[model samples]
Target: MATPPSEYAMSRTPHFQELRMASGSDNLQGCFHLLFTQQYAEIDGLINVLCEKRDDLFKKIERMEKLVEEGEGLCAFHDSGNVGLEFMKETLKTDKKVLAALTGLLDMACEGRREKRRHVSRFE
Candidate 1:
């Protein structure tokens, strides 16, 4: 049966020490120790890669949050600008109506003066 990882770790420590002390030879325990050491190195490398990827993901999330805030600010600015534009348009419409009324008043005054001139000339 395969040993559990925790038990294998415990068992491998003493064997690793023994393998280090012994001369390089065809020893089964030494071979197993070397294999376990290689596997542990590979696992450590994978863990480092995973940590790097996690940090990159966090940075991307922060950037997205900042972008969202900027988008909201732009939307608010545009809404206020639209409201100001509408107010200006309404003011312009009122000003046009006032100008038209003033023009009509000036025309009536000139027409009344002409009628007075004609009546005065008829009397002379």
Candidate 2:
């Protein structure tokens, strides 16, 4: 059977109010702790990702250096071909353009590497 509201039920009963307060406090504490724990976990994950990105950038720089070295070797070989320099002056001019283009590309690659390092450093 349903009971009618007592004076204590309609008003703030001390015992019931204290129980509610205690439970609320406990719940609030648990929520704050969980929030802090999640924040720490996210921070750790971000650090790991940053480290991996830095490693990847370093690998890219290594690859670019290798490419530049290979390009330089090819340019050297072209310049050293059997034909006399005077006879191939026009051809050498075209070769110079190719070398210049390769150099510009290498410069861009180096700049990209530098920018990546800067970005990764800031994240760290």
Candidate 3:
């Protein structure tokens, strides 16, 4: 029944979408229903989109770093000349592996939630 994203009235940001069903049922007069939903598959799509963006940015950064290193000639061998280069490369590698593993995890979790919600007795 719950979770994720935004645009305009809700910008495209990562956030859990909480749907409070105030009157979907008449029997629950004084109680409110709480559910989580991702309006446009936002939660399911977040990781892919985010990873793609980060991968692109990292590529651009890698290109720039390459240029800087080439310009530095022998300085590229010095640790001080390329402070975070190795770290950024490692991050790029980790992101690729992590993204592959995480791609549909949110979707699976959300489906489980939907299954549980559907089984809940409507009268309780």
Candidate 4:
């Protein structure tokens, strides 16, 4: 019997934590702008990682579906597959929403850095 993926696989990855830490520090306006740029880069990396994970998740689901079909409508490993399938559905939805939020944050951060540059240029 093939074991399903652990929920930990869908957890906040290491890059995610690094981004949080990088974005939380206080510094000068110039330094903050640099950090924000770095944050955007990190966010892009995180998004790519998430996309890969989501692809893997979908493949896992497909395998599960095949197993169920092979069982001829009865999952011998468990009484029913509904619980696991529903959980995966919810996880996928949550993952997508998180990605959307991260994208929005990246956009906001980029705009903020641009505005800061504008302010500095105007003062010079």
Q: Which of the numbered candidates is closest to the native, going by highest lDDT? A: 4
Highest TM-score: give the candidate number: 1
Compare candidates 2 and 3 on TM-score and give the better one: 2
Task: Give the per-residue lDDT of model 2 (tens digit) for 41-121.
Answer: 554565556556555655655565555555554555676543443334544455556555555555555555555555444
Superposed Cα deviation of residue 2, candidate 3 (Å): 21
- 99, model 4: CA deviation in Å? 0.9
lDDT of each: 0.53, 0.50, 0.47, 0.55
Which whole-number lDDT from 0 to 100 does residue 21 have in model 1? Answer: 41
Off by over 4 Å in 4: 1-80
Candidate 1 lDDT over 1-124, as tens digits, reads: 3332355654777765455445253444454555545544554565456556545655655565555555555544785755655554565556555555555554554555455445444433
Give the per-residue Cα lDDT of candidate 2 at 101.
Answer: 58
Q: After superposition, how far is residue 86 of candidate 2 from its true place, in Å?
A: 27
Q: Which lDDT value does model 1 have at 46?
A: 51
Model 3 regions lying over 4 Å from their true place: 1-35, 74-124
Candidate 3 lDDT tens digits, 1-124: 2221224523432222222234333222112232223322454465456557656756765675675556457556777655555555566567566655554564565675555455333323
Pairs of colliding residues, candidate 1: none
